[model samples]
Target: MLQRASNANQYFTHWVTAAPESRELLALCLRKLRGLNKVRIIDASFVWTEPHSKRIKVRVTVQQEAFEGAIIQQSFEVEYVVASQQCPDCAKSYTANVWRASVQVRQKVPHKRTFLYLEQLMLKHSAHKETINIKEVKDGLDFFFAQRNHAEKFVDFLSSVTPVRVKKSQALISMDIHTSTKSYKFTYSCELVPICKDDLVCLPIKLAKQIGSIFPLALCHRIGTSINLLDPNTLQTADLPSNTYWRAPFASLANATELVEFVVLDIEPLGEQSGRFFLAEATVARASDMGVNDNTYFCRTHLGAVLHPGDSVMGYHLTGTNFNDPQFQELENSSTYSSRIPDVLLVKKFYARKKKPKRNWRLKRMAKDEGELLPKKADQDRMDADYEMFLRDVEEDVEMRNTLALYKAENKKEADAMSMTETDLDDDDEVPKISMDELLEDFEDLQVGE
Candidate 1:
């Protein structure tokens, strides 16, 4: 209890630790002095120096009418002690490799082009933001998350954009006997379809019949949520959905690595046209066999609109070539599909280039953590080749370039100022380049030093 001063009426002061506000402090004082007689709190006000100040002054007014029907007032002050603390869940985030769930994405193919494309898609959609860490493995990438739901969300994103089959499993991490609580670490093993764009996939007989009766030897022209295939002989196109692909999956017989160059001897376009593809018959001879032999191959191609008589083209030579795939062997043995198979399936027309053209624009790459184990010399070379192929595809395919962010190269002015020889000028004219309008200025480099 507090009483009036002997010399004069004085205001009383009190200190409180971590008291919230004036109203709460007044309530606390009222509760403490509830047992006292004829004492009532009228109002209270608080003033703080800063928004998050640790100390505050609270003025609380009290009224006492016990002395000869006269009223007396008093004030009080409180100081709060602020401290920081972390909960168990938040503390786990600061620790290394403390993920509760992980998604291991894998592809059985021998190249990394598909993974590079998937990385761009994930970055464009901002799907990788939820992941705690992304580590690159030999075949694919592994995404880690602090929660199972985050991993599931990432898996859903992968399934939506690409053809992948997911196998989920959970491991027991910890258990509490008193609370009957169990902690689990979940793992999602996701395997992407081995097929990629521009690859020659030998579809299963039954699967081919189901997808619009297209040819078994079809070229994967485009791959999105579904695999888009084109039959060069008939110019017929079909789509193989992700679900259908996983149920009866088949591998690609030949990819860009197996492409054999051929010079177009003659080309005549037919009246039939499907979008950008024009049906035409072409007489092509192997580039290696041009001067040695007069042998030439007569085949149907869909690139008639773009190909010229003297142009070089890349295609897969099927005649006299033996493949170990069961699907290809079955097609070869079957009387129904054996005769319909073409000797050559032209993939893309090639442009003459003595050297790589100087580009004024560049693409941004995702910062991914490749594992600590250094790759072997052969594996490293293969990876480099695959990345170069991906870069070329990005440059040639306008649709692909649209999905990625292109920035103006920092050395664009220097590249533009450099003089090119006659040969370099000719190469620059032949090679595809991105326009300046399509590239965005990168302002991240504009930050001035503090």
Candidate 2:
């Protein structure tokens, strides 16, 4: 009887806040109200004493709490007591620093290309839906969540896309001694390996041999659950798992920023094939040294089918460039590995730059808080350069496009008018064009959010 009285008191206190409109609906709502126990409601009727009265008189018929199966009837009057109050969740949103969990993502690289790629992956998978706030810090982006589970899910998503190491910690926020209940703030420090696609990685000799007998110098072909490294000389590829990578961490000797433009003077197929790449010997000259010096270099590359006499390409000038890495030092000091290093390592074939280039496809970006302090001019320039390079990568690489969601441009007539020049450019087979079938029509404008 005490428990029944307690449940009835709790239920009726909030009943007037959501009273049903019609008499039948009110009776049905009363029947479903959570209070009655050891008693089954058979019928409920409501009577208004006055036409516009604020009180409702109700009679409920229920089964008695006994094996004899007696029927009992009760009548009660419910009065309206309306007051304005804020719910806990709504109040919490209005306050600051109330997040229970946070994930700090950091990459020690100089450029933001990696973050751009990560953002695209997050968008493709809809991984940031649960985040309450995303803030851009000094080195990386921070994701804030209301719960620890959401932060853990974000950490898992980061682990699946790139090679990252995570450290977890929690701080006691508040404690209740009477009930022995406590509140804690959780934080996850996630650090990504400072290597990106097309980066020239000088692997540790021992680690290189353990994963695959590929050369110590390799190119980061792609990043997924593991670091995919490809030997430019032999076209041999190896996947460095996240666990194995953390066991012996290594940094890149050079990244795409150090790439030098070279014009292909001559190329010949060596009749060797590996997937989409083919072995060939190419004679290239530095674009800067084209007219100033007649110096040309003969090096072997994997892009045999794509290279032509007049095509320009980008590669690392490894001949006289000094690297301060331990692995590079080891390779330099050892006679066995010294001869295997190439003078110029070709990264990718270059394309003609348009005077005014416009894309008919667009990528969705996450609305992130970049913090209050504005970035320095140099830092902003570097970020713009990285984003531009990433955009070019998406346009040139079909495999990359497959992993991202591309929406058709909002301006159809402008896109159609620009298509003519694109068609003309595609005729030379130098520029890559994304098929219209691959683009998704954006209907975001039609959506009405609640």
| Best prediction by lDDT | 2
State TM-scores per candidate.
0.74, 0.75
TM-score, candidate 2, is 0.75
True lDDT of residue 260, candidate 2: 98
RMSD of 1: 16.7
Predicted candidate 2 versus true structure: per-residue lDDT over 1-450, tens digit per residue: 001111111123332223234554454346555576666767766655663343345566665655476556555444433223444333444467689999999999878888888888998899999999999888899999999999999999998888899999988654444577777889999999988889999988889899878898999988888999988778899999989988888889998889999999999999989988898999999999988999999899988989999999999999989899999999887788988888999989998866445665677778888788577998776776676678779888878889888876665344433111122333345577777899887677456678
lDDT of 2: 0.77
Count of clashing residue pairs in every prediction: 0, 0
List model 1 lDDT by residue over 1-450, tens digit each. 322122211213332322345454545444444434566767766656574553445565677876787787776654443333333333443456688999999998878888888877886788889788888877788888989998999999988888889999987654444576777889999998888889999998899999999999899998888999999999999999999988777789998889999999999998799988899999999999978999899999999888889989999998899899999989989999999988998999886654344456655567778779568888776776776678778778788788777677764333322121111233446577667788777678676778
Q: Alpha-carbon error at 324 in model 2, in Å?
A: 0.8
lDDT of each: 0.76, 0.77
Candidate 1 structure, TM-score to reference:
0.74
Best TM-score among the predictions, by candidate number: 2
